[model samples]
Target: MRAHKITFAALAVIAGLSLTACQNDDDAAAKTDPSPVTTASPSSGDSGSDGSDPASPEASSGGKDTSAGTGSDKPGQAAKCRTDGLKITAIDNFIDGDPDGTVAVEMKNTSGRDCVIAGFAGVDLKTNAGTLSAERKGEPGDPYVLKSGKSIAFSVTYPLNETGGSGVRITGLVVTPPNETKSVTLPWPGKPSLPVTDGSGDPVRVGPIGSAGQGG
Candidate 1:
C-alpha cells in the first residue's frame, strides 16, 4: 500500500511538471508572435522623411522655386510693345496709280511673337524748311495684342498742295513707336508737296492708331 502511494505521488509530480512546461510554452508563443492588425496608420500632414510638413512654405517651395521661373510650363504675362520689332510703312497712295496727301501710316509686327500696342504712333515729317511733329488726336483705347504677320494702320493728315502757294518739300521722315524711345528713319515719299505751316505750332496731325476696319 505504501509503494502504491509513492507511485501515485510520483505520477502527480510528473503531471505538475508537464502542466508547468505547457504554461511556459504558451507564454513564449504569446511574446514572440505578432498580433492581428487590419490597416496601416494614417499619415500626418503629409510629412516627409525629414519631418517637414508639406503644407509649410519652406517645404512646398523647396530650396529653388520654379513658380516664377521662365522654364516653367505655366503661362506668363504679356510683354509690352517694343519698337525694334515694328515695321513702319508710309502709305501715300490709297491704291496703285493714285496719290493722296493724308499720308496713311501702317505698322506690322515682325517680332515673331505676340506684343501689346497702344496709343498713337509718332510721326515726324522732316523737310528742308522745317520739321513737323504730329499732334495726337483723341484718347487711346484698350491695348491691342499683335501677333506675327499682324498689322495696324494709322494716318498723318496734311494738305497735298497749296494751289499757287509756295509748297514745302518733303525730304526724309522720322517715325517713333508708341511707349518706346527708339525711332525709325524712312526716306521721303518721292518728294511730295506738303502744305506750308505758318510756324504757329505743331503742323502735322496724327490720328490715334486703331485696328483694321476701325476708323479714327
Candidate 2:
C-alpha cells in the first residue's frame, strides 16, 4: 500500500511540471509576435513631402501668370494704331471737280488686332511748288478706339475759284494719322489745279478726325 501511494505522488508531480512547461511556452510565443501597423492619409490642404500646398497662391497661379498686364488677353488694352497698319484713301466731294469742294480722307485699320486713334490727322497737299500743310480747325474731342477692320476720316474744305485765276497744281497728298509720326501718300481724287487764293484770297482749311461717312 505504501509503495502504491509513492508512485501516485510522483505521477502527480510529473503532471504539474508538464502543465508549467506548457504555460511558459505560451508566454514566449506571445512576446515574439509582431503588432499591427497603421498609416495616415493626406488631407485636402495638407502639403506632401515636396512642401507644396494646393490652396496656396503660387500653386493656384501654376508658377506663371498670363491673364493680366499689357499684351494679355484682356479687352480694351490694345496698343496704339500705327501708320504701317493703316490703309488711307481720299474722295473729292466737289460737283464737277470744281473749287468750293471738300476732300474726305479715310483711314482704315488693316491690322489683325485692335488699336487706338485720337486727335487731328496731319494733312499736307503735295504740289509742284512745295508741300502745303493744311491748318487744323476743330476740337479733337476724345480718343477713338479703332477695332480691327474699322475706319476713321477727316476733311479738307476750300473756297471756289469762280474767276479762273492761276493756282497751285496739286499732284498728290501726304497724310499722317492721329498721334502717329509715319505718313502715307495718296493721289488727289479730282482736278489737280485749284486756285491757291480763294475769291476772298484765303488759304484752304482742314478739319479734325471724325467718324467715317460723315463730314470731317
Candidate 3:
C-alpha cells in the first residue's frame, strides 16, 4: 500500500511539471510573434477647396501653364499696318465750326489682309524756310484695327494766325504712318494757314488716329 501511495505522488509531480512547461512555451510564443499594427494611409485624388488637386501631375511639377501660345504665335491679333499699300488724302476745312486751325489727313488700308494702326501719324509742315515736324499731342489709346478696304484719319491742329502775326506759312505736309518709315506728301489743302510760332509752347500738334469721320 505504501508503494502505491509513493507511485501516486510521483505521478502528480510529473503532471504538474508538464503543465508548467506548457505555460512557459505559450509565453515565449507571445513575445516572439506579436499582433500586427494597423496604420492609416494618405488619401489619393483629394482636390482642395481652391479647385487644385494636391496629388495631381500639375501640382507635383510646379503649377506652370504652357497651353497658351508665345512670341509670334499670338492668336486673333492682326499684324501692324504698313504704309506701302495705303491710300492717303489730306483735306482742308475738313471740320467746320473749328476755332483752332485744323487739317485732316485720312488713310485707307488697301492691303488685302487685316492690319492694325495706333498712336499718331507723323506730320511735318513744309514751309518756304524749311520743314517743321508737328509734335504728337495727348496720350495714345488702344490700337485701332483697320480691316481691308477700311480707313482711319487724324488731325493737325494749331492756333490760327488770325492777327496776321509774323508766323511760318505752311505750304505742304509730309505725313508718315505710325511704325512705318515711309512717308507721303500732300499739298496743304487751303489758303496757306499760318502759325504764331512753331516753337515748343506754340508748336503745331497732331492728334491720335481714329475713325475717318473724326478727322473730318
lDDT tens digits, residue span 31-83, model 3: 77676777999767532322221222221122211221111113444556788
* Model 1 accuracy (lDDT, Cα): 0.57
Deviating ranges (above 4 Å) for candidate 1: 1-75, 93-100, 197-202, 211-216
Candidate 2: tens digits of C-alpha lDDT, residues 36-153:
5678896565222222111222211122112212222333355566899888899976677554667888877788865555567888888877888877787754444455676777
lDDT of 2: 0.62
- Alpha carbon deviation, residue 77, candidate 1 (Å): 1.8
lDDT of model 1, residue 69: 16
User: Could you give candidate 1's per-residue lDDT for residues 1-216 as a string of tens digits?
Assistant: 111123666667667567678567667776666466679898655222221111222211112111211111123433445778878877563343344346666677777765555678788878768777768866765455454566776767655554566578778778887877898888756337665656652356777766222221
How does residue 157 of candidate 2 score in lDDT?
Answer: 71
Predicted structure with the largest lDDT when compared to the true one: 3
TM-score of every candidate relative to the true structure: 0.56, 0.58, 0.59
Give model 3's TM-score versus the native structure: 0.59
Rank all candidate structures by their lDDT, best first, as comma-separated numbers: 3, 2, 1
Which RMSD values do the candidates have, in order?
19.0, 21.4, 18.1
Note the residue pairs that clash in candidate 3: none
